[model samples]
Target: MERSLAALLVCVFGVTTGEFVLAGILPAVAGDLEVSIPAAGLLVTAYALGMIVGGPLLTAITAGRPRKPLVVGLLAVAVAGNLLSAVAPGYGVLFAARVVTALVTSTFFANAIVIATSAAPAGKQASTVAKLVFGMNLAMILGAPLGTWIGEAFGWRATFGAITACCAVGLLLVARLVPGDQPVTRSRAFGEFTVFRNQDLVLAIAITAVANIGLLMVFTYLAPLLTGPGAFAAAAVAPMLLVYGVGATIGNLIGGRLADRALLPSQLGALAVLVVLLVALWASPHPVVTGLLVFAAGAVGFSVIPGMQTRVLTTAAAAPTLAIAVNASAYQVAAAFAGWLGGRVIAGPGMTSIYLAAALATVLGIGLSAVALRRDRVRVKQSVLR
Candidate 1:
């Protein structure tokens, strides 16, 4: 990998690690801060809220800036946030620090994606984007776990301190290696909102929001699903989740390859496969079979992401950062909705039905994706006639 891309990948990994590492250390945080676990859990909600609210606004606020400087600056903000988190004197301050960290998270990620994909070799955008996405996959697999370990071994504050150090390394690399030649002199501050008027762009964003809801919901509840319906030992949850992460990593790479060949068709096919796989998880009669199903679900479920993200970037290439930021925000919104919907499903139907509920959500995503593609085709034919 190019050093510049590597730096950006590290930034992606560090920033994402900041987003998720809270899960592993919430108990430590709550106990130290003298707050309840649920209160510390609100730290997660606050970060998500910040991302959903902050990404587009910040992206728009900084439209047309030089990409290199913007991303580096955002990483600097991330460093400050995490440092504040490490030294926060009380829960209120730590909560603020988390929101501050999250506010820059998605926007920084969007800019990095734009930078990386802009520098990609021709016809390799999806594959390149996947490389950046791979950083997030590693965050789930490695960064979060490592940070959790640091928290366990030292203290929760040490986890944030470690994240801060990682972001600082990414910042130094980005400053030294990533090229700053790209500039968006044409991007209007608020005029980028006009991108929203594009039907395909709208659909691309919708596909992201709708399709991933299923997998996110199911994954959110996977531990329970494993120990409950699958009748696995409680100790087995982490290993099974590891199985899913391995599958996700492979799926991300495969999705990148498929998307480079054919973006929408591959996305559609992947979504179909995801729906089938989610539904398929319903029939796991043995532990080994259940593990395999979890892996398949992870693989097929994540295979759609690269295409989805790439479509938004391509559709809004004139000014892709804000669009990408909006797309990120949409995914956050989907995650929140998935949490709510999964809760309802569990309360009403039961834990086993969560899989079916997730499958149904993706089926809705399929419908939206089909509509978006059809609209794009019609627009193309009309313009060709014109």
Candidate 2:
């Protein structure tokens, strides 16, 4: 079981790297593709759009397949997609490759989460999920900075090529280490929607979306934001991102433990921290202050992931795989919307607009959580009465 989890974590690291690696190298991509920086930023939107469409669809199509092979197959596809990206001749080709890559990436998350939670010891679902998600934080820590440096030193294409190699290594490790051959029970495509009947599930998803909107709005354009006002030199972006990555790792670990003890409180506390961090991030302009705020933003921003995912999974226990897939899709939808919204703000009201807008979005998320908590209490009281 430990080996399986380790393999899944490595696999997740590769996919997560693919997702956020673009952020650090956005400017390099824009220059290479002869497009505007915002245009390059839209690559994040494109990938998110693909995940939005593919998460449920691919999960439905591949339902009941043998689990281990399914993961390996998806990783192979990711390898191909990244390879295409590495050799893309223009913006259009790279855009197509990103969409294709995201389809596999979203499906991989659904499968891997189901596998991890199932293999986990009793009462450790959130912790196990956090462990898998640690790969994402790790990617942010290592992959994003390394990819950024590679893009600067070599070229953006070289960054993709390096990711391609990582995906291949992940593919091999999964096929060898993840021990599973059990086939899922055949499931109808439409059955995935049954989880939505529960209002708690719906509310949990909404919270996820709203929270992400706040994080990604500022995060998607962080490279430029750091460089814009001489807040950091061109060479300093990677180190700043590395700092954020470290904070993210710490937050994810603490969030998992807190959620295992009390889901609602963990989420609320994280959001509260985020509100403060976003304000500081916007108001502070000094290099030291901005760097510290960036690290805090990363820490506070990601601390709710385990709680949020655990809430959705428990609420939709009847359709765990599909529900997990839907939550993954929700994240992508949030990313796509936030990335596009950030681009629009960057174009019009200027870069500073993103932090303020993100802070307001987080306040809305807090309101949604209050409503959800109230509803949960009412439901519990009714159950006791019955």
Candidate 3:
């Protein structure tokens, strides 16, 4: 890995840990803050709203700044935000702090991807992005668990302290390693928005948002699905989620390599397989089968992400940072929508119906990918005639 990429990896790991660690600590947060667990859960919602609304807007606002300093500044703010969370006086204070911290998450991520990809060797951008994505994987696999352990051992506030300390280390690494003279495109804020007018770019962004809904939806409800229909004990939830996370990490790396070789084809295959896995999950065939499929579903589901990000970056190279930030926002939008839709499904049909709904939702992603693939062929043929 490039030195800069490694540094950004640390940054990604830290910021994402902050985002994800709340799940394990929410009950603790509620008890301390004198709020209901569900109310405390709104902190997650606050962060998503921050990422969704803040990412593109903040990236565009900082578009004129030097890349190196921008990332450093963002991470510094994140460190402070986490510290604030650690010492927040009440739920309201903690909520605002989370939003503030989240405001920088997507912008930092967008800049980090651009920095890493810009330094990548030819034809290796997607894989490079995948490497950066390992930070998120590590956040899920290692950081969240460790943070949860710390919270349990100390307090929920201590979890924030640990995350803050990690962000500070990431901040130092980023400043030392990332080049001082990293280039910026320096486009006007409003002008960057014009990239959205490009139909292909819009489609790439939409594909990312649409394709991820089912995966996030199911993941959000994995505990209930596993316990209720899969007939697994509550004790099984943690280990099963661990298996899913491991599969996701492996899939992300493979997907990166596949995307580097053949972007759309790999994405199409992954999505198709994911659709099948979701349908199979709906069957609730057996505990063993369900467990295996959980892992496979995670692998296939996340395998599409690097390609999705690559497609967005490819389509909007002139405004890659803004485009990717918007892409992240779109993903958060999908997550929010997926949660809402999943709730409706749970309320109406049943818990098991989530998988069926998920599979059907993924079919839309397949259609979009197929259409994008066909257009690529048409564009190539036309260029040949010309």
The numbered model that scores best in TM-score is 3
Top of the candidates by lDDT: 3
In model 3, what lDDT does residue 63 have?
Answer: 76
TM-score, prediction 2 = 0.89
57: Cα error in model 3, Å? 0.8
For candidate 1, the per-residue lDDT at 312 reads 95
**Weakest 10 consecutive residues, lDDT, candidate 1?**
182-191
Cα lDDT tens digits for candidate 1, 125-226: 998888899899999888988999999999999999999999999999999999879756566678788889987788899899999999999989999999
Residue pairs whose backbone atoms clash in candidate 3: none
lDDT of each: 0.90, 0.84, 0.93
Q: Write the per-residue lDDT of candidate 3 for residues 158-178, one digit (tens) a residue.
A: 999999999999999998888
| Best of the two (1, 2) by lDDT | 1
